[model samples]
Target: MLYHIRCKKGDKTVRTIKEVVGHHFVQGQPGLLMAHCQNDERVFINFDHFDFLDFSNGWAKGEAIVAQKAAEAKKNEPPQPPPEPVINGPGGAS
Candidate 1:
């Protein structure tokens, strides 16, 4: 879903936000962000930040990312031996 903030000031041309209310160090970039209008609060997080080990039980972080890239690359390559020929029987069903 998408939303337009109806109450915010300025025209639709506003493209940059320079203000920083606060800051906190995060191990990795955030994957999610949420705001609370009434409470004047916000949350940003990367769920994987909690524990690197927990993210991938037996694999290292770098290996996990690399493995995913290898898997994607494998998808683009053609089959090694080529596909086997399909033969149709003349009688009825084979």
Candidate 2:
């Protein structure tokens, strides 16, 4: 889901942040937003610059917020251990 963050605050045009992610506002950081952008870039943008945020899939605010929470929760989880390697022996193809 690509999101368009428009900076329509002032009279002049500002850089529009676009990516395959819903707009995620950073916790504990007022006016700060995080976006997963093109080329697999994770960017921290100033929300103060942008006037609006919209998901390409037409996600409502609540849905996007829920998605953001889920994403953040996943990120907070500890990394899992790699699967044990398989050993080839006379019993083969185990």
Candidate 1, which segments miss by more than 4 Å at Cα?
1-56, 81-94
lDDT of 1 at 92: 50
- RMSDs, each prediction? 15.5, 7.8
- In model 1, residue pairs whose N, Cα or C atoms come closer than 3 Å (at least 3 residues apart or on different chains), thus clashing, are none
Per-residue accuracy of model 2 over 4-93 as CA lDDT, tens digit each? 654444455465567656446687565566777766777776644555444455753445456666767887899999998787997865
- Which segments of model 2 are wrong by more than 4 Å? 49-94
Per-residue CA lDDT of model 1 for 4-76, tens digit only, reads 1111223332222122243232323332222222334544433244222122123333444465456567767
TM-score computed on alpha carbons, candidate 1:
0.27
What are the TM-scores, per candidate, against the unseen true structure? 0.27, 0.44
